[model samples]
Target chain A: MIMKNDIILAGVGGQGILSIAAIIGTAAVSRGLYVKQSEVHGMSQRGGDVQSHLRLSSRPIASDLIPTGAADMIISVEPLEALRYLPWLKKEGWIITNTKPFVNIPNYPPLEEVLATIASKPHHVMIDADEIATEIGSARSANMVILGASTICLDLPFEELEQAIRSVFGKKGEEIVHTNLSALRAGRDFALQHKNQA
Target chain B: MQKMILLGDEAIAQGAIDAGLSGIYAYPGTPSTEITEYIIASKEAKNNGIVANWTANEKTAVETALGMSYAGKRAMACMKHVGLNVAADPFINSAVTGINGGLIVVSADDPSMHSSQNEQDSRFYGKFALLPILEPSNQQEAYDMVHYGFDLSEKYQIPVLFRITTRLAHSRSGIERKAKRAQNEMTLPGDLKQFVLLPAIARRRYKGLLGLQPQLENESENSGWNQYTDGPDKSLGIIAAGLAYNYLLENFPEGNIPYPVLKIGQYPLPRLWVEKIANECETLLVLEEGMPVIEEMLKGYLGNCLNIKGRLDGTLPRDGELNPNLVAVALGGKMIRGEEVPSLVVPRPPSLCAGCPHTDSYLALNEAMKVYGKGRVFSDIGCYTLAALPPLEAINSCVDMGASITMAKGAADAGLVPAVAVIGDSTFTHSGITGLLDAVISKSPITILILDNSTTGMTGGQPSAATGRIAEICKGIGVEEEHIRILKPLRKNHDENVKIIAEELAYPGVSVVIPTRECVQTLNRRMREKFKNKKTE
Candidate 1:
């Protein structure tokens, strides 16, 4: 059977979710899969909530936007943003999200309450992506960490994703690429460890 | 054919390039800016000697493109839906003047007001101007339609309106490129007086335009972009227009929508297909991305005719962009209800970036205007418009692009002392300059605060026409050189900036205060580029 994955990547503006989408989209295209991505741009980029609907399919994709409650995965760079897109997630959708709260508003919900809301999801993996990236010597690679956690749900070959990170960040230099790869591995390891424990 | 992934805007730009376009003119606006940007970025377009440049506003852009068309070269003008209002005069008149070279005016509509002030549909403009419109359903169609639009425009001797909504404008899909044609040589219209719109000539030209309606409609009927696909069920007929077709097709991934579908991309209504579907199906569902133009047309003025169900009949929403989920429900599919977002997730509205020059400028303006009080300051559109929000509710009015200076002048004329106008540098050039000229001529007691950030900060920092020429333009507009004060908008210079603003506010004549600073975003981008270059060195 041909593989099809409808993913919603969510985050605040400047959270580097577009980079994540680009990396995954490049990977999907390289594997000869049909890819369509719809992104939020313009005024919303000023720290507002943003989400990109990315669809990868072996069959031809009709729409750039994924249908609500049909998305296979919700990968978010921020905890609150992950919950914002619950309406678009399928019943069996996996929520791979970073544990950080990008507190820009005055009345942000308590962190524990936000975590509890995400925890309510049937399949979810929460990780301190920023901490993991920092530990891996690249604090800015938190987006890659979140992407790494999503690999558990994504059906694409892991090696393709690793290669995507290299190509997408190749312009940044060899050091940054190495650091981001390590961050991705750390996030994957954490998810695997938690899943094994459960 | 080489296929490349492109946004709908980029696809249109690429299509125009391949269609032998000689020039593209535009003013940067969301969802539409990328069209011209793509043309400017293309090495092929550059080598082809295409004239792609930002105009003062949509009006100048359209007029310039019209001039290029008069020279017998394919040209395009693009802007947001609201920008159409600014270019409406030239656009409407172009239909009457007709064309020598092919002309396509692209109006990227924002149905949900994504980054726009209003969700006005541009299809109405096309109909109002009595011009054929091409509304593509997908990125590939967006590409292919540009070539068709230019051909239709040339064949009919009328400018064609190409309309797209925000969803299609921003979405990305793989598009197969066509063989590129060479650019047209400079060739003038056969009649020297063709563009001259004297009353008698205009009447004749208007008649000529009115006479072309049949041909335009005939073209739309045979346009291939418009299709009538038969289905098994006759219970419901779907009239899907533009990007709404994608949403409709998305509901039935198997490509087996039971209802007969008439997918419309070209305008003149395609009456033949419409009549066919109306005769075939019992009930009609009109799915359009923008306002219910087609739905209302199908329903007619009376309450009667076919059982038409759409935005007006409440089958779908009256406003906002349509998505697949909404279409699914309309198609009688089960509503896929997912978990509701927690109320704890507060709204995170867009704000000025940290270290934005507008923040410091607003702070200083607020302090300076504290004595005279709030509500006296009028602001224009840009990132600076965000100052109307909390922490710095410095500006009172944000009516339009250049309303700040004019509104402030009117307020001052009505005896409001120290009436201030806060406008960005790019906006100042866009339309604010004319208002300033009005203020200067009347000697209106207004402190026009032109925030010279050296870029159009709101729409992704496109190079502004007023970069180094603001002070010169002010002086040329007859503002006193002594009263034109420029200050650095920064935390450290806050006190000095406030003092300068206060001095301008106290001036009884037209005084200009310019808080000069580079936009933080642009500054960071420059620094990053510089750092990259240094590393390479």
Candidate 2:
């Protein structure tokens, strides 16, 4: 079996982008699949852009960068960043992006314009992740929300994803653990409800 | 026991704790910070009376660990790749002054310049010091290596370096940990002459280090971590090192590869496997991260028939960290899509955190130097260096720690008016103090702004070395008390601080202005702790 999917997740630092990619990668690997991941963050503490690439398959991943037009999916936590990586998405590939942009990036594309561009694509999910997160009790967790939304297109089982999340962040604290688990469930539910609407 | 999830760094710390480490001393740097933090916060570690604390800098950290080792205890000194340069003077000399107990130097290298100035390979340092180096391919190896590293250090009577790169240090994997080992009995150094590095004794210890090299290499050849794989096909052999070998195995669909594989984790190349793979295969690909040091060495040993290929042959990019895709390309397989990378806009450079004291200090410095314009102020490394970017381009030069003070002095001596140096509290402690002493002795007409944020600030605000005593140290170092000025750096205090800065800059002789404030991050942490304490109280 050939390993074919390359997934890139990009957002400003402090968005929990790394954790999201890590969870999905872990879930895939736990199922006896091969996975490779690379992360790039410049001064992560200062809130700069952070990008992580996850390549998944039954075989070993080859490249660190999700080459242009080769990304099976690009899960972005911010709208502008999703547009930033738009050129990398395959013609029919899926993009799951949150509507609210991180306030830090000096100049960002307007939310609607970004939504319109993503809508132009064949397969896309534009989520008001912050709104969903705020309803779920924390806007800081839009990352998991987007991750959950993207799972609609990925081939992994929901149980596997949940197990990875529990294993990864369960040590953080019970309250935080419950809230984020709720957020992930909310995201997956949202995606399942509106996946084909666009 | 249940499989507990652990970061590679945490696993190393767990392994150290399991190995009954006496202490962990380190200067916080990315990829290495979590190791020290893990030890400090671990309940099991603290309950076992293990000591873990942030050292002033990498040099002091290593020296303190050496001191612990000399007292017949296992000690770990952790530092990032460049921090090793700061600690190299002691590191190289430590080989000559052998230890009484186990000493493990944890060097976490950033192969892609990830949060670092350079991508230097520290494995070379191990070879240069004639020290046995154990590299782990995954988190389990990282943890297990620490325990094994201590045993090896004790067995060989030499310090061992546990080398990890960004990937191994940051990645998370399932790690099966062993039961805790009993602590080594504390005993003082037997021979005073052995600990002292006087020329006579140093020469003898140097000979001892050299004598142990052969045995170390032989042990490496036989190490379980170093494996020789035999498969059905032998057309093209692969010599994969560290995590690259793990990445390579993913490419083969079946458990067996089409060629013989020499997966190396121990340093000082396993010659037998090299000879075996080289003699059988027509072409060999050397896969490793960072530099082509191993490839260079392999080429010399293998005849022309081996046809060695790696970074040196442009099969791999000579720079940046490697991933499996890069290794697959070296193996002559299809590159990861072989598609062109989409263009990305040049990223906006990193800036100081919002409400950071460095931001306020930079603003005040800019306001004070509105007349001097852009090119007058010099700065050094630390959080304040971020002021060189947009919104507050106050600093002019930053070349390593302590360069600001000395470089500004040189410019002033060469006739630049109102020359200034701005260094963070942590950077000053790292190297700026001696430069300040130089300014005082020379009486250079330079204004040095010691931006005291009371934390390192850049690498997540581990306690600043000069947190409690920059002022006293400055006075003790011979700067005139009258020439030293201190001001609280805050938005409300900005005007007063700027005025104080102006007055100090106008002074004829060497002047020191310390704009003081606790880092906002630290302040928040303190606030949280205060709230927690109130509840407990």
Candidate 3:
């Protein structure tokens, strides 16, 4: 069977959601699957909510936007942003998100309420990705961690995503690439552990 | 052949380059900015000696592209939908003037106001100008249409309007490449009076354009981009245009759209195929991304015999962008109900950067204008316009580009002493200079605050045309040299900036206060590049 994954990557501006989309999109293309990724730019980049629709399939894709309630997964770099796109998620859709909050706006809800709302989802894996990335020696690789957690929902191979990370981050040098790879593995390990326990 | 992933905008740019484009003129706006940026970054474009640069605004850009076409070289002018409003005069006249070489005007419409002021469609503009329009259904089609658009422009001797919306313009997909073609050599029109739009010449040119309508329609029918695909079910015939066609196909991923479909990529209404579908199906559903131009045309002003369904008949939402789910619902598919978002998740509006110079400028202005009270300030479009939001409601009105100066002048004339105008450096160069000249001529009692951030901050830090020349331009515009004040907009210089603004406001004549600083985003980018270079060394 040909694999198809419709993922929505959500975050505030400057959270590197486009980077995640680029990494996964490049990996999907290398696997000879057709990929369509829709991004938000311009005025929305000034600390506003942003999301990218990423679709990968064996057959040719049609629309650049993924239909409402058809997304297989939503990988968010912020806790509140993860909940913001719940309307796009399937009933069984997995929401793998970072637990850290991007508190750019005033009147931000309590951290516990945001966490509880995300936990209420039928299928969700919340990880302290920033902490894990910091532990992995690259504070900026938190997005890589979220991408790793999403690998469980994606149809592509883990090794392919690893290679994609190298291809995308290769210019930054081998150390940065290795750190991001480690962060990805740590996230995958956390999600796998949670899934096994469930 | 190698394939590369490209945004819809980039695909169009690459298509133009491969189609032997000699130059591309554009103003930096969302979704459309990347088109010119791609050409500017391409080594191939450099090797081919293509002229790609940001113009002051869309009007000058279109005229520049028209001039290139007059010289018998293929050129392109791109802008967002509202930008078309700025370039409407030259754009409409370019069709009457026709072309010596191919010219494609790419207007990327923002259907949902993603980053724009309005969601106006560009197809109406195409029809109004009596020019051919090509709306691509996908990135590959966006790539291929440039070649066809240029050919049609050359053959018809008219500029082609290439329309796209936010989704397609910002989206990315893989596109295949074609062999490159050579740019046209410099040659003029055979007739010396071709571009002369005097009354007598214009009448003959208008007649010539009218005569070409049939050929344009025939080309549209046979364009192969517009197709009539028959299906087993004949209950409903779908007319899907541009990105709307993609949404329709997405609903039927099995490649089995039961209804007969007329996929329309080229315009002039392609009557024959449309007639075929209308004759076959019981009902007609027009799926267009923007307005109901096709639906209204097919249904006429009165209701037609066929059950015409679309934005008009309430089959789809009357406004906003059409997504696959909405198309699915229109096609009688089940509406999937998902989890609702908690009300606690408030809206996150876009704001200025933390250390934005606009904040300091506004702070000083508020302090200086305390005695005068609120609602005396007018602003223009730029990052500084964000001051209208909370924490600093510094600006009162934002009408359009260059309107700040003129509006402030009018207000100051109407007994509002010391009326202030806050405009950006790029916006000043774009349209504010003329208004300043008017202020100088009338000696309007307005204090113009030119926010000189050394770049266009709102549109992601494109280089400003007013850089290093604001003072000279102000002086040349006849603002008194003594009253032309420049101050650094920073917290450290807040009191000094406020004193200067107060002094300018106290003056009865036209005065300009320029708060000069580099945009923090661009400064950071430069710093990072410098650090990278040092590391490399």
Per-prediction DockQ scores?
Answer: 0.81, 0.29, 0.84
The full ranking of all candidates by lDDT, starting with the best, is 3, 1, 2
Q: Local error of candidate 3 at B148, Å?
A: 0.7
Summarize candidate 3's per-residue lDDT along B28-130 as a digit string, tens digits. 8886999998999999999999999899999999999999999999999999898899999999999899998899999999887888777888999999999
User: Could you give candidate 3's per-residue lDDT for residues A28-91 as a string of tens digits?
Assistant: 9889999999999898898889999999999999999998888998999999999888888988
User: Which structure is stronger by TM-score: 1 or 2?
Assistant: 1
What TM-score against the true fold does each predicted structure earn? 0.98, 0.90, 0.98
Pairs of residues at least 3 apart in sequence or in different chains that clash in candidate 1: none
TM-score, candidate 3, is 0.98
Q: Is the docking of candidate 3 incorrect, acceptable, medium or high quality?
A: high
What are the runs in model 2 whose C-alpha is more than 4 Å off? A1-8, A18-42, A53-72, A83-93, A110-113, A135-138, A154-182, A196-198, B231-235, B300-306, B337-348, B529-537
Better of 2 and 3 by lDDT: 3
Candidate 3 residue runs with Cα over 4 Å from true position: A195-198, B303-306
Candidate 1 local distance difference test against the native: 0.91
Q: What's the residue-level lDDT of B277 in candidate 1? A: 95
* Model 1 lDDT tens row, B1-537: 536888899999999999999999999999899999999899989988998999999999999999999999999999999999999999999998999899999999998888888899999999999999999999999999998888898888899999998888998888998888887788999999989999999999999988988887788789798899999999999999998898898888788888899999998988888999999999999999989999988877895967998999788999998988888888878778567777888888889999988899889988988897768989988988888887687888887799999999999999998899999999999999889999999999999989998998878889999998899999999999999999998999999999999998899999998889999899999999999899889
Give per-model CA RMSD.
1.5, 3.5, 1.4
lDDT against true structure, model 3: 0.92
Candidate whose lDDT is highest: 3
